[model samples]
Target: MYKRVLLKLSGEFLSGDSGFGISPDTTADLARLVTGALGGTGVELAVVIGGGNLWRGARNGKGMDPATADYIGMLGTVMNAMALQDAMEATGQPTRVMTAIQMHAVAEPYIRRRAMRHLEKGRVVIFGGGNGAPFFTTDTTATLRALEIGADVVLMAKNQVDGVYDSDPRKNPDAVRLDHLSHREVVERRLEVMDATALTLCMDKGLPIVVFDLFQEGNLRRLLTGERVGTLIES
Candidate 1:
């Protein structure tokens, strides 16, 4: 269903059993799942990872200066990016970590054209550092990259949940799960699936997004094969 995809993974998802920081085993599992989906297939992937496991610019540093807190959060994302890149490489998948901020020693600077070329050659590119500026979320970055790369869909690999619901399903057991929704519905309902800016960007670009549980084994493969296992946000 999709020749190219942009995968958005929250940093918390990488925290294996401990629920904080990068867990080698968990990252390895995710890498294996991603490679399994793309291996022997001509699918291209670009990954955008969040830093919530380490630090969230808004939630952390309540007393600290906003800029300092955001910078710390960006660094956290770089750390996760490196870990994911290593895990993917260990699984025999070619990967690259590109940062919005210039970090020549650790990653390449974000260049849309070069990233597209890498994808074209079957290399998975992981974008980190969240627009290299304060206030913009990684969700927005994922949407922007998806449009730049002409991805068929954005696979929002969430932790511990499958699909979008009218309310937090964990809290409200009776929350209705939505199999399909329009971007406008997400915005109008104020669903916290993604930031409003990100949702609007996808809406404007006409990019579909599939919000699914990354922890579910083989769910990524099912999504790539066009299985309607998650909430699809489209026109």
Candidate 2:
């Protein structure tokens, strides 16, 4: 249903049931799912993944330097990018690992035109390093990249969460899942779909967002095909 989609993956998801690091099973499963989706449909795909499993930057306490912590986190993302790329390529899917920070030996520099070109050629592009700057989440990087590439929608792949709720479902029994929401509503209600900056960018660009459970089998493909799989936050 969508021409091109940017899939935002969290580092937490890559960590699988474990609280930290990559799980071979989880990474392989994701690679297969995404590659299968590409085979079935002609949707151009890109990815921006978080580095929470490794380090959360400024969020890390104990007076650590924010920029240095963020840089470490960015490097963690590069590790993730390389791992995902390997998995995809192993499954016969052409993939590119692009990074904001130039690591010539590992990933290509994030060049806007080149990235768009890779997408056009049906290669899955993985964006790493959180915009090559500190104080920005991968969520914001996904937003910016989606705009740059003219994506049809941003597919937010939450770990186990199905959608946006009025409160944390894990904590509140009465928390309500919102099936539909506007950008204004998300900001006004202070929903936890993504960072405020990222949502603001989406609002400015008139981009639609789908926040769904990535761990749920076939949910990603279902969301891409316009099936009801998760919360549709847009307009």
Candidate 3:
């Protein structure tokens, strides 16, 4: 069981069936679920959300420069962070949105000590903007924050997949799911569970990661309760 956990949620998951932009209803539902899981447990929570639903750096601007595209993606993540913070607060949960880039009017500049203080007080902290630089993914940010904040585990919430598989489960009916793995094995096998940098960081820090299907009812709660419902990667 984790005393503190960092949840990594992709922005696309917030979009629901629309596949783009934030869906208030869906986000509200997610907020309820998160609050339910956190209620009375006193588990410290931090979140990192992706921006694929709004814009993906790799797919933006078509022929535009890569740096420009990535910047747009970073902006998109900030957008999601603000929305998620609002939704969480609406559910009566005190939440803070911290950005790697200093956007004072929009979010607090990321300060490690302040974030840890928020966690100690049971506030949900949402880290956004993807490292505030180009060529780095939110996955890496999640890993970095998890280690920096001394999180007990990182819960990776996938859209539908339950765990890491040898192959794409959608494409291969026979794809094998791994219930457990070592950090070394995940990297050596080239599994797509997390980005290479994130994987390496977890490995170095001996951080445990849980990969689970976020769409499954009560799975997040189960994960927080220490129920083994998905694959776990550990050192």
Candidate 4:
């Protein structure tokens, strides 16, 4: 099993089946999954959740300033982080909601050393605010956190998709799921795993990524147990 890992969760996942606002049922389900995975032993997990449900800079802010829209998206992520934190805490698991924008009233400031310390104490750290910068997606934030904290692997929890496919599976019935891929292959093939900048960072750092469906029963547990359950992208 990996000693430590970073899990990238999109805001749509927290919105549940409707793909909108937060859903208590889905949030509770996610909390239980993390609780089960951690069962007092296994990988040290850190989460980076997207704000697409509440805000999408490019998609929703067509007439607004690009940077301003991005900041709004970042704030949305913090809100989602707070809800997830509450649910995780209810599970009896120590979890911290760290924000890049320094929301002292709600979340602690993002300190690299302090985050590592939390992980050492078996606390699940959730990162929000999208690197505290505009024009950067949460994907970049996840990769940045993973690299800074020396994570062994990045577990990308997709909402419905099971793994990386050659093409859009929904549009193309013939799209094939690739079991494994190299970082270079992902880049060359232009896979939709992440943005170019974030993918490049992972390639530079030699960080492996596992893309899998979050709703798959026992999939998270299977991953924690070192059983391959998704498309593994490595160096």
Alpha carbon lDDT at 192, candidate 1: 79
How well is each residue in 45-76 modelled by candidate 4, as lDDT tens digits? 89999998888989999999999999999999
lDDT value for model 3: 0.90
lDDT of each candidate versus the true structure: 0.88, 0.89, 0.90, 0.91
Better of 1 and 3 by lDDT: 3
- Model 4 CA lDDT for position 71: 94
lDDT of 1 by residue, 1-235 (tens): 6799999988987898787888989888878888887787678889999998899867788998998898889889999999999999998899999998888999999999999999998899999888888878889989988998789998898777899999999999999989999999999998878888889999998899999987688788787776777899999
TM-score versus the correct structure, for each prediction: 0.95, 0.95, 0.96, 0.97
Q: State how far residue 170 of model 1 sits from its true place (Å).
A: 0.7
Candidate 3: misplaced stretches above 4 Å?
none
Range of the 10 consecutive residues with the lowest summed lDDT in candidate 4: 34-43
Candidate whose lDDT is highest: 4
**Model 4 clashing residue pairs (backbone):** none
Clashing pairs in 1: none
In model 2, the runs with Cα more than 4 Å from the true position are 59-61
Give me the overall lDDT of model 2: 0.89
